[model samples]
Target: MSDQDSSSSSSSQTEEELDGEMDEETNGEVEKEESHRDSPAQSLSTFSSSLRAVIRIKQKYQVMKQRRQEMALALSGAGTFPGAPTRTSPKIFTFDGVTPSAFPMLSSSNPQKKKRRRRKRVLFPNRGTCRSPPKQERSRAKYCLYLLFAIVFVQVYNAIENLDDHVLRYDLEGLEKTLRREVFGQQGAVEGLLVHLKDYLSTYVHNKPLVVSLHGPSGVGKSHLGRLLAGHFRSVVGETLVLQYYVLHHCPQEADALQCAGDLSAIISEMVERAEEEEKIPLFIFDEAEHMQDEILDALWTLVASKQSNEYLNAIYLFLSNMGHAHITKHMLHNSSSTSMASGRHSALVKELTPVLRSSLEKLHQLWSEANILPLGLLEKGHVMECFLDEMTREGFYPDHSNIERLAGEIEYYPAVGGHEYSQTGCKQVVAKVNLL
Candidate 1:
């Protein structure tokens, strides 16, 4: 029985040893599992950090690309094309928004860098912002307004340059009243004279000069009417018509009629020659032609005949004389029946005159045939008033009808010879005097 008890005790001790070994193995396995789980957490944290760095690098690269494109566009003189890349880099910032930290790697340690940076800041203060206005549109609007003002100033200067000082201005009403009495009242008498003058001018007279003699008493305004006709002719034609003034006063010193004819012929030839070369037709006005030497009349007759071929020399000789027509015609008949007889009497009388004078009178009859004669009569009361008013107005003075009546009364009844003494101011003064009376 003691041997059986010893075997049982040994088996119990073996069972206790096996239980301790199993517990040690279990504890080691639990510790290894805890270590494996902790290692995974650390590795995950490292991976996350690396991924964030990569993303930041990519974002920085994109911003740099945009900045480069914007700089190229601003500095280049070339205009941008369609579909060009327009993106600009965003400006990088430090912790404080006031300071920029972009491209800090490019900064230098040299003192010159600070100066360059300062200049850059001055040139482009908002360089970081880089937002711009459209440039081309603003410049075009400024140019258009400048052009408009220049055109208006030129037109005003041209208008002031064309005003004339010599032009005479008159009311149309006053002129019509004068025409009614002088031109219309004479019935066909004035019309007949104008018709005859027109016919003589148009007709080709062979060596025969047209002598239109206007004979009337003094203060009749005959010379004034002649000037008016000459003015009308000039207006119709583009150029002025030349009218030569000749005054024939009775020369008490002249020996005979022929000598006077020679002198007159030389004067007519010189005037006619000048008119032909200048392409002008002249009117010879012989004022007081009746008082001329008989020789002078014959010399004029010769000149009219010699100028037949010269178209420009085909002239109108207006003889304003106080001599009656009957006396003139009777004198012509007594000379001779011969065609040269009219000029011969003057030639015979002036044979002893200068050689130049003798040669001039040789063709006196021909010149006489080319002349036309027209008689001027006294102006009617209305016509006289109209002329006086016209003269006053043209001198920058205005006159009423009462002024005209007074001027007409002062001059019309007075025995003043010719209208030369009828001064425009004198007419006005006379009206003022009458007003006082």
Candidate 2:
């Protein structure tokens, strides 16, 4: 019985060992078959995937390249900016690692970049945006914009200041009234002055500057007219607008041309500076244009052409001269026939003399005339008496009717003998004798 139990146990143990070996062999066979089946498909799939990844990388590179080219063209026009950094090759990068400013097309205020930029800011505390490429462009553009604005403002100001004559309006009638009230004679001359000024007010005339030459014999109130002009304008505009220069006083016979020019330039520069404030033209009066040196005249010609001098001026230039008028001939006998003849003759003489200045101006090519010849004809006994009486009244010596007759008799009166003749003793002498009377 013991031998039988032992045999059974040995047989069972051998059978268990055999069963384990068979199970192991079957499992190995199954695994080998499965591996064999998967090998080719897996290898093929891996190759295809790698190819696709390479194609995608190339496509991304080409797209990035094109974008870079566009940005280069935009920022530098045709090429790269001088002294600025430029990239030569395309670089591969993940979205997380890409620089925010690497793409110029991106908006600066992108929300996604804010956290990354903030992190970078902490890491690079000394890196201010002033050295950034985009900001530099913006800074230059701002400067250009300011320069353009300034140029435009200057052009607009100049255009408005050089307005045309038709656009100008003033109390011309008021000026006429003022002249008529204060002055004794030369009604035609006064009217002519107004007409010229009207032309100057518009672009059609000498709008930048109008020079007026008052040609007449001495003591015909040429200087007086100038004073009246100064007074009239000073009252309305101000004292600064009018500049008076006596040709005899400022420019002596011995003074050189350069000296005269320097003196005039100083005056003109100062006048223009002051006139700029009011935006109105300034006035210049040359008391004796005839006595002005030839060199001074030439210098003036050059000066007038400069906008720096004439642009701010009133366009009114008055020159007083001893010569240039045709005196009235014949004595006033208080006879109607003689008076009529004398009046007719005087009218003819003035008519002829009016063109004389115009002709001279054309011949000399001188704007120096601002020319209009209005002869202050010889004052008749009546006119001189009127002037003398006016003077006496102003001096607190109101002469009665008989006193006036006696004063007239005491005054020597010389009349123009002919159209070509002039008064040897104009009212100039008559003025001195008034105090004696």
Task: Give the per-residue lDDT digits (tens) of candidate 2, residues 103-200.
Answer: 75675656659867887778755556658555433468889999999999999877766653234434566778888876655666677777776666
In candidate 1, what are the lDDT values of residues 170-237, reduced to their tens digit?
21223334433434113222444455554544433324445565544454445554665555545532
Best by TM-score: 2
User: Would you list the C-alpha lDDT of every candidate in the order shown?
Assistant: 0.47, 0.61
Worst 10 residues of 2 by lDDT: 327-336
TM, every model: 0.37, 0.52
Give candidate 1's whole-model lDDT.
0.47
lDDT value, residue 117 of candidate 1: 88
